[model samples]
Target: MRITTKGQVTIPEEIREAAGFGPGTEVDFVIGDDGLVRVIPSDRLRGERAASLQGAISRLRGSADVALPTDEIMALTRE
Candidate 1:
């Protein structure tokens, strides 16, 4: 696909879906030792960071491990 004057080329819908590139996904382009350019999704790293810090977050909530039903979890998020 052609890149616009803004240097933005549209990533295909299939590629986007496969890479989980939803709105506001941060990405980086890196050149590997093999001289191949790779696209890395930084947003996923953010998620990884959050997951790694889950224990700290839980601690803030008094380390409660109450298991809520899936529906209840969904309901709270929906609100």
Candidate 2:
């Protein structure tokens, strides 16, 4: 398994299947604290980020209790 001139190495079919990597799959390379590199699906990271964003949004929900309508807010801003 040699890296191409473009620094691209093909993952073996077995590894790809085991890792659930299909064609057009987006992957991320992570270096562990133990000095091991791993390839992970980008959606996995997105899922974590989505969860974090959901939590943040949930916390902020209802925090903005505005009584003004859109037009009124726009008018105030314009003024």
Candidate 3:
């Protein structure tokens, strides 16, 4: 498969299905000393398994909240 002018290449359907990759799924790339590239599920990239939203919220319960100005929040949202 060739990369388009935008430097985008379409992942083949068979590969995507086999890897369980779908819309919104994330992946990571690793380069070995031997110059081999490996594609890994994003969850394994940071040595973290995906957690539910509830778990994430629970983990943040004790974190201090920093209030941001409305304009800053809006700018961040746009990004």
lDDT of 2: 0.94
Against the true structure, candidate 2 reaches a TM-score of 0.62
TM-score of each: 0.49, 0.62, 0.51
Report RMSD (Å) for each prediction in the order shown.
11.6, 3.2, 9.7
| Decoy 1 TM-score against native | 0.49
- Candidate 3's residue-wise lDDT over 1-79, tens digit each? 8979997777899999998989888888789899997777888765554456567989989785888899998998999
In candidate 3, how many Å is residue 9 off? 1.4
Top candidate when judged by lDDT against the true structure: 2
Pairs that collide, model 2: none
What global local distance difference test value does model 3 have? 0.82
Q: In terms of lDDT, which candidate is stronger, 1 or 2?
A: 2
CA lDDT of 28 in candidate 1?
81
Segments in model 3 whose C-alpha atoms lie over 4 Å from true places? 48-79
- lDDT (C-alpha, whole model) for all candidates: 0.84, 0.94, 0.82
- Model 2 residue 27 distance off true place after TM-score fit, in angstroms: 0.8
Candidate 2, 1-79: lDDT as tens digits: 9989999999999999999999999999889999999999999989988999999999999886779889998999998
Best by TM-score: 2
TM-score comparison, 2 vs 3, better candidate:
2
